[model samples]
Every structure is written in structure tokens, then in C-alpha cells.
Target chain A: MKKNEVPQDKSNLESVNFKELCYAVDENGEYTTAHSTGWDPKTIALNKAIEEIHERTENAKQRVLNNTTSPIEYYMELHKMDLPILSSYVGFWKWRVKRHFKPKVFNKLPQKTLQKYADVFDISIDKLKNIADGN
Target chain B: MEIKFTHHQSAHCENGVVSNLMKHNGFNISEPMVFGIGSGLLFCYIPFLKVNHAPAITYRSMPGSIFKRFAKRVGIKIKHEKFSNPKDAKVRLDQNLANNNPVGLQVGVYNLEYFPDEYRFHFNAHNLIVYGKENNTYLISDPVMESVTSLSEKQLEKVRFAKGAFAPKGHIYYPTNFPKELNIESAIIKGIKQTCRDMLAPVPIVGVKGIRMVAKLIRKWPKKKGTKVANHYLGQIVRMQEEIGTGGGGFRYIFAAFLQESSKILKNPKLAELSTEMTQIGDLWRDFALDLSRIYKNRSAKEDAYNNVAIQLETIADKEEVFFKALKKAI
Candidate 1:
């Protein structure tokens, strides 16, 4: 891309008002660095990925509200983590983590187990046990 | 105490850190030169490996490999350490700072407060320099940022010990020795040859073949995975290519810059011509990304949008195959 041709489209980066450094060919055909606010294609792709995460988080929240799953599932989705990643952070086996997704199993969990989940999510134990409305 | 570090923003994080650190050590290495000497360019698509719930596609070498390769090839002695606990990591970092040593650190981007929200993710391969610490804040020289920034002690600790795939584990590295003068000519030649080998590797999941494999998967995704999932997959490809500190166009432009610089250093005019060709290929990659985005946005006017983007990728693969072959012959 030419130096002057670098995309400067407004994007989600506008929230932080940051410009990304990019490389382009100057008038002399020499490579140089240019700052890009964003490009349309990248912006769209990022928005789509973020949207997917939000959709999954919302789905998990609904399941928790219906008592189909536990608050662990909701918090995991809220933090953009899948089961394997959550298990690794919480130092639990994959199957054990999956078991905790059940409200019945999660409710019977000890304070230590709840504390591990709370620590990973960087939230309080009381908050981990209860789901806040409109979070 | 500050180590008098000067930050020069670059197109990629690892290259930026290496280049900036080299300059601080009294060597003037450009970012592209650092990237090129490190043989940082590659294309790989791992179907079994998942990142962000999508198949992993990497446009560069593994996280710390660039600096490792670059240092070895350029005859620089370096030291690297990874701590299991943050307490030890903090003590070591403080010791380095007290001695006026600026060290590069591998950290996760998720909790980096200076990063924009849109760019924050669980990626743990981001590199930066910790030049000094004042009270509770660590001075940072993140190469992707326009200016130097700072992170609180707790925030820095959180990112350094971030848990997930490719966890940073409080990693720290710095160059300890350098030759009287760099062998730029041989280093550039070696870098070029390795890149050629990587691009032309025979493995189906690597190099030029890897690019082709992704093209094949793109054709099947819409029919097999449903539109929503396929669109998400396509978005993942573009994000990996353009969004993640690639210097735009999947590090192709940086490689092109490297080639251009090498042409002047090695006195090989053939490399200059190839540099232009590589830039055109980078443009092709950008076009492919734009077309893929159009399909996911439901704005593609073409009847067979998936097939069209797949064809675009195939064309890119074909050009890259021919380009690498010639590049190998040029040196």
C-alpha cells in the first residue's frame, strides 16, 4: 500500500483514540511507517468477534437464569473463556470443571472451590455465587 | 532508575522490542532488519489447535523464536529466564532495573491497561521493555504503542503471570554480549535462506502449502459449518492477518521492507525487484481480507462469495509459491 493510501477509517479503536503503526511505500518507493486509525476490514472483523463473545455471554446468562447451568458458566463466558481455558486457570480437571457448570453441583461446592472460581474471574466470592442483573 | 531507553514504535511487537533493545546496547538495528535476521516470517494453519475458538493461523514464527534466531545468527549472546512465581520475578526485575539494565518481557495483552479495549485479548506473546520502576509503576516501552506508557505493580504482575495458552510466566530476556561488528551480509543471507525454506516447506500444514490448505477449508466452511460459524471463522482469519500487530497485510509488508533493506546491504539488485513483487503480494493479501470481510458482512454482491474468496487465497498461494522459489534462487 502507498503511504497516502493507508486506511484511516474510524473504528472501535476510537474509544481509546489510538492509532496503529503500519508500513507503506512512500513516493520514492521506500518503505516507511504510517499511523492508521483503523481499516474497514479489520474493524468489521474485530466487531464480529466481539459480537460473538457477547452473544455467547448472553446465552450463558440466560441459561443461568433458567437454572439450566450455574453461575460458573456465566462468569466463564463473561470473561471470554471456554471450558478448557477456565479449567487451566482454576487448576481443575476438565471434567471437574464441566461438572461445576451444573447448578446442583456448583451449589454444593465448598468455599475453597468457590474461591478459586472467584479468583480467576477477579470477583468476590459472594458475587461468584449470585448473578447480578443487567451486568 | 531509568536505563535511558529510547522507544521506536514499529509494525510488530517482538521486532520492535528487539530493535529498540539493540539500539540501547549501542547497535543501530532497524526493526525490519531485526525481523528479517530472525527469520520471523512464516505461514501455518493448525486445524487441531484452537485460538479464540477458531483454528489457529499464524503469520509469524513462534513467540520467542525470532529473537533467539536473530541473536544466534548475528553472534549476540543473550540470557532468558522464566519464573514460576511472581515474587521471584519481581525481585529479579527490580534487580535488573537497579543495575540500569532494560530488559524485554513477554506479557499477555489482556490486562495491559495502556492498550485500547478493542485490541485487548488473551494473547500472551506480546513483548515490551521494562526500563525503570518509580514507586509503584513500571515504565514500559511497548513497541506497538505510539509512546511509552506505565503499568502499576499489580497490573504488571497480572499480565506477566497471565494463565492460558502460551502463558508468559513472567519471562525476561536481554542481550549480554555482542561482537565488535555485526556480520550483516551473512546474517541477511542466512535469514533469507531460512525464510525461503519455511515458505517452500513440503508439509501440507506449513508454508505455501499451509496457505493453500486454508483456502481449501474456506471453500467448505460455508456449506459444512453453517453461515454464522463460517463467518466467525472468516473473521478469525482476518483478525489474525490484520488486527494482531501484523504491520498490515500479515507481515508481508515488513518482509518486503526487510528485503528492500537487504538489497542495499547485500548489494544484490535482484532482492530489490523481489521486494517490489512481495509488496504486490502483500496487496493481494489485503484484497483477500477485504473480500472475506464483505462476505461476512452480507454485503458481497457476488453469487458465490465463499468460493470467490477461496479463489483469491489460492491465487495468493500460487504467487507466494513462485515468489519464494525465485527468492531462494536470488541469494
Candidate 2:
């Protein structure tokens, strides 16, 4: 990519006060560093991934609302985490985490286990126990 | 107490951190030169390892390998430590800062408050430096950022001990000694040779072969996994290549820049010529990424979008195979 041709498409990065630094060839064909506000292709790809995360979060929220799944599922998606990742953070086995996704299994859990999940999600025990309306 | 440090932004985090740290210690090493000597360029597609719900695709070497390799080649004695507990990590970092030393740290990107929301993921290989602490905030020199920033003690600790894959458990490193002068010519040759060997490795999951493997998988994904999963996987490829701090074109441009700098230092005009060719190849990778985004975004008019992109990747792989061969012969 040439220095002049570096993409400056405004992106989500602009909201966070960051600009990506790209290496581009200058007019003399020498490599130089250039700051890009964003590139369209990258933005599109990133947005798609984020969209998927949001969709999952929404679906999980619905499941929790119906009492089919626990709030653990909803909060996991809200934090952009999957079962394996959430398991690692909470120091729980994969099977145990999968079990916790069930409303019955999660409700019977003790304070210590709930505390672990609460800490990993950075939420209070009450918040983990109760999903606020419209959230 | 804070050590006086100057920040220089680079295209990649590890290169920038190493370059900036070297400068702080009175050694002026450019980021490209550091990257070259460290042999940071690589391509690996780990099918068994899932990151972000897609197969892990890495465009560079494992995290911290660049600094480790660079320090060894250039006769720098570095001290590396990892803490099982955050308290010990905090103590050691404070000790380094108290002694007027700026230490490099391996941190996760997810909890880094200064990072853009779009870029914040579960990636744990990001590097930065802590020069000093004031009150409760630590002065940070994240080389990817335009200017230096600060992170609170709590925020810093959270990222330092970030869990999951490639988790950096409070890792801290700094150079303890440096040679009177660097062996630039010898180091450049070693770096180039190692990079060539890596790119041409016989392994199916690494180097040029790995790129080909990804291409093959792309061709099968749509039919085997359905369009939704296929597009998600494709988006993962694009994100790995273009979204991360790859300096554009998945570190191809950076490698090319390294070659251009090496050409002058090694007095080999052939390297300069190859550098231009590499740039063209980098452009091709960029094109590949663009086409991929189009397909995932449902904007592609091409009938066989997945197949077209797969072909494009194969073309890139073929070019890279030839390019690495020539790069090896050039030195």
C-alpha cells in the first residue's frame, strides 16, 4: 500500500481515540509509517464479528427470560465470552460450566460457586442471581 | 520514581516494545530492524486450537519470541519473569520502576482500557512498557498507540493475569545488559536465514503450506459447514490478517521493509529488488482480504465467492513460496 493510498474510512476506532498505524511505501518507494483512521474492509469484517456476538447475547437473554437457561449464559454472551473461556476464568471444568447453564443446576449452586461466577463476570452476586428487566 | 522514556509507534506491538525499550537503554534500533533480526514474520493455521470460535490463524511468531530472539542474536542479556500471583508481579514491576528501569510486559488486550472497543478481544499476546507509577496509575508506553497513556493499578492487574488461551500470567521482561556495539551484518544474515527456513517449513500447519491449508479449508467450508459458519470463519481470516496490528498485509509489508533496510546494511542490492516484489505480494494479500470481506458482508457479486477467495489465497501461497525461496537465495 502506498502512503497516499492508506484508507481513512472513519470507523469504531475513531470513537475510542485511536488510529491504526500502517506501513506503506512512500513516493520514493521507501517504506514509511502512516496512520489510518480505518479501512473499509477491516471495518466490515470487525462489525460482522461484533454483530454475531450481539446476536448471541440477545438470544441468550431471551433464553434466560424464558427460564430455559440461567443468567450465566446471558452474561457470558454479554461479556463476549464462550463456554471454554468463561470456564477458564472461573476455574471450572467444561462439563461443570455446561451444567451451570441449566437453570435448575445454576439455582441449586452454593454461594462459593456463585461468587466465582460473579467475580469472573465482574458483577455482584445479586446481579448474577437476578437479570434486570429490559437488560 | 519514573525512568525517562520516549515512545515510538510501530506497526506491531512486540517490535514497537522492543524498539522503544532499546532506545531507552541508549540503543537506537528501528522497529523493522528489530522485527527482522527477531524473525517475527510467520503464518500458522492451527485447526485444533479455537480462538474467538474460529480456528486460530496467526500471522506472526508466538508472542514474546521476537524480543527473546532479538536479544539473543544481538548479545543483550535480558531478565524474564512470570508471576503466579498478581501481588508478586506488582512488587517486581514496582522494583524495576524504582530502580529507574522500564520493563516490558505481556498483557491481554481485552481489559486494556486505552484500546479501541473494536480491537479489544481475548488476545493475550500484546506487549507494552511500564515506565513509572504516579499515585495509583502506572505510566504506560504502549507502542501501538499514537501517544503514551496510563493504566490504573486495578486495570493493569486484570490484564496482566488475564486467563484463557495464551494467558500471560503477569509476565515481565527487561534487558539487563547490552553489548558495546551490535553485530548488525551477522545478525541480519541470521535473521533472514531463519525467516526463510520458517516460511518454507515442511509442516502442514505452518508457513506457506499453512496458507495453502487455509485456502483448502475455505473451499470446503461453505458446503460442509453452511453459509453462516463459513462466513464467520472467513471473517476470522480477514480479522487475523488485517484487523490486528499486522502493519497491513499480514506483516508482509513489515517484512518487506525489513528487507529494504537490510539491503543497505548488508550491501546487497538483490535484497532491495526482492523488497519491491514482496511489496507487490503484500498488495496481493490485501486484495485477498478485501475480497474476503466482500463475501462475508454479502456484497460480492461473484457467483462462487468462497471459491474465488480460496483461489486468491492459493495464489498468495504460491507467490509466498517463490518469494521465500528467492529470499533464501538472495542472502
Q: Please provide TM-scores computed only on chain A for all of the candidate models, following their numbering.
A: 0.94, 0.95
Ten-residue stretch with the least lDDT total in model 1 chain B: B295-304
Q: Write the per-residue lDDT of candidate 1 for residues A1-135, one digit (tens) a residue.
A: 999999999998778777889888999999998999999988898888888899999999899989999999999888878877788889999999999999999999999999999999988988888887446
Candidate 2 per-residue lDDT over residues B40-146, each given as its tens digit: 99999988888778888989998889998999898899999999989999999999999999999999998999887767888889999999999989999999898
Q: After superposition, how far is residue B269 of candidate 1 from its true place, in Å?
A: 0.3
Candidate 1 per-residue lDDT, tens place, B1-331, comes to 6778898888899999999999999999999898999999999998887888899999999999999999999999999999998999999999999999999999998888888776777888999999999887999999988889999999999999988889899999999898999988899999999999999999999999999999999888877988888888999999999984798899999999999999999889999999999999999999999988888887333448888898899999999999999999999
Q: What are the runs in model 2 whose C-alpha is more than 4 Å off?
A: B299-303
Please list the residue runs of candidate 1 whose C-alpha ends up more than 4 Å from where it truly belongs after superposition. B299-303
In order of appearance, the predictions have TM-scores of 0.98, 0.98
* N/CA/C clash count, model 2: 0
Docking class of 1: medium
Second chain TM-score, each model: 0.98, 0.98
